[model samples]
Target: MGTQQTTQDKYYVVVAGDTLSGIASRFRTTVKQLQIWNNISDPNIIKVGQRLLVAKATAGEPQPGDPSFVPFPGGEWFKTLPTSPIIEMMGLRLVEEGCGAAYGFSGPGPKWNDKHRQAYACFQSALGYSGSDADGWPGRKSWDQLRVPFPEEGCDAQ
Candidate 1:
């Protein structure tokens, strides 16, 4: 669908798979600018079907590509995993992204090994999460950005 435009800004309807970064990238704006315009506290907590206003950048406004965003894992997680497939998938994706030189590669394994955590933290840091945000806690924001694959659907007892 086309973005709606107003007198001084544009608008986008959040879809099922929309992220602030993705949206900002599409609109040629920054996540921080979108947040400031929309009063969003968390860049990762956008609701589906939500209409977001994008203020049009003037000549002096910070043009696109202010803070380049690192790409996240481009995959979905299983809904009902037998084990910790989510972590494993993230780890695998990290290695695929060439950020796992220190961790090597061992995805779809049973354990959320040290390599997994290190890769996850690396991902967080790349996404600009420093301090406590990059604590490798598998937060929803990062997980969403990671595009966690859907689980097998009913494997809570392994």
Candidate 2:
């Protein structure tokens, strides 16, 4: 019955005797997820005092159309687009939603490709969309639902 030590309910600090599986079990997540979130290539190497993201960041008080929020670039935009940091953010969101399989070994790179569409389709399916609606296109509804954060600094995508 060891209590879990966390910060802001988002991160967990590793303590002596802590194991990745134990932490994942306590957090109701998977070890693979812990590895992915923390970028830990070796699950056995977590050290004491190490901080790890155990939960997704909540939207909190931020609302749509906020200056720091990313707006939908229209469904067609995902089709004809070349590359944008926004797309990378979208793919990251999709992967966060359990659609990482779409990217496979390549991952969600900063490119608009079939992998992006496949991941978007998984996201749309997760939202209960089907058929043409979930045809892997980034519609306004799904785009907003994805809740892509504002692009990182130095990224030119809107």
Candidate 3:
């Protein structure tokens, strides 16, 4: 299909697989600015057919090399702890403890062992649980009782 043009002022067309970040980067703007211009309440809800109004270029526009185009990860929450590390640690401990066979690790290797320990540490930090580095291995309590911050809606917009 041919490129779609914006009629209401200068706007950018949302393409397939296009994220607000990617679009902002291309146009030397920010995701926040795009959201504000388009009255976009939901940053994640932009569709392929929506037109995003970029700011009108004026004489005082930001220079090309300026750091004005970085796209923010505009989710409802800040970066929380990642869950993969916790899961990996649990799986690794199961293998090391002879409770289950490890899927990705082949035989006894230092890399796998180190990875398991790292995962355990991450899991501890995420759950706000504390333990000695040497003694902290994946446990049922750590894995099962991990709590993540949920996105709270209807709060005042920042």
Scored by lDDT, the top model is 2
lDDT by residue for model 3 over 1-158, one digit each (tens)? Answer: 11223333567788899887566545544555677788988767789988888745444433332223211212221123223332333343334333333344453232325445454455455446665632435443443332111122211112
User: For each candidate, what TM-score against the reference?
Assistant: 0.41, 0.59, 0.34
Candidate 2's TM-score reads 0.59
Alpha-carbon lDDT of model 2 = 0.73
List the lowest-lDDT window of 10 residues for candidate 1: 64-73
Q: State the lDDT at 72 in candidate 1.
A: 32
**Order of quality (TM-score):** 2, 1, 3
Two-way lDDT contest, 1 vs 3, winner: 1
All candidates' lDDT scores?
A: 0.57, 0.73, 0.45
**How does candidate 1 fare on TM-score?**
0.41
- RMSD per prediction, one decimal? 14.7, 8.0, 17.2
Off by over 4 Å in 2: 1-62
| Candidate 2: clashing residue pairs, number | 0
Worst 10 residues of 3 by lDDT: 148-157
Which is superior by TM-score, 1 or 3? 1
- How well is each residue in 2-74 modelled by candidate 2, as lDDT tens digits? 2223334488899999988677646644566689889999977899999998755544543334344477877
List model 1 lDDT by residue over 1-158, tens digit each: 23233345668899998888778646644566588889999987999999998656343424221222222322233222324544555565555444576464334354665656677778788778999898655665665455433334422213
